[model samples]
Target: MVSGKRIADVGYKLFSGSMMLLTVYGGYLCVLRAQRYMQKQKQLQLAAQNESTASETIKD
Candidate 1:
């Protein structure tokens, strides 16, 4: 009976550790996604600025 309890405890600990690892990995992915999003936004803003400048030059 005691041996069975010990096995159960070990299994639970392993499962908990795996879950924590997965959570950390998920957080890392989210940071990468946010960085990509910010980079894309910056590129779009720069493109718009360039377009406006070109239009102004053409008008002048």
Candidate 2:
């Protein structure tokens, strides 16, 4: 029969490794999605500003 200590140690290592991998992958995906969203937002903001500027210029 295996000792309780050995089982606990193995479980700890397994959980720790899985958690580390999950965190790394999660962080990478978050960064990728955030960048895409920010880029889209920036494009929308610039387009709106340009439209406003164009309207003002036409009135002058």
Candidate number achieving the greatest lDDT relative to the actual structure: 2
Separately for all candidates shown, the number of backbone clashes (residues 3 or more apart, or on different chains) is 0, 0
TM-score of each: 0.94, 0.70
lDDT of 1 by residue, 1-60 (tens): 569889999999999999999999999999999999999999999999999999999999
C-alpha local distance difference test of each model: 0.99, 1.00
- List residue ranges in candidate 2 displaced over 4 A: 1-7
Runs of candidate 1 with Cα error greater than 4 angstroms are none
Per-residue lDDT value at 40 in model 1: 100
Q: Show the lowest summed lDDT stretch of 10 residues, model 1.
A: 1-10
Residue range 7-45, candidate 2, lDDT tens digits:
999999999999999999999999999999999999999
Model 2: pairs clashing at backbone N, Cα or C within 3 Å: none
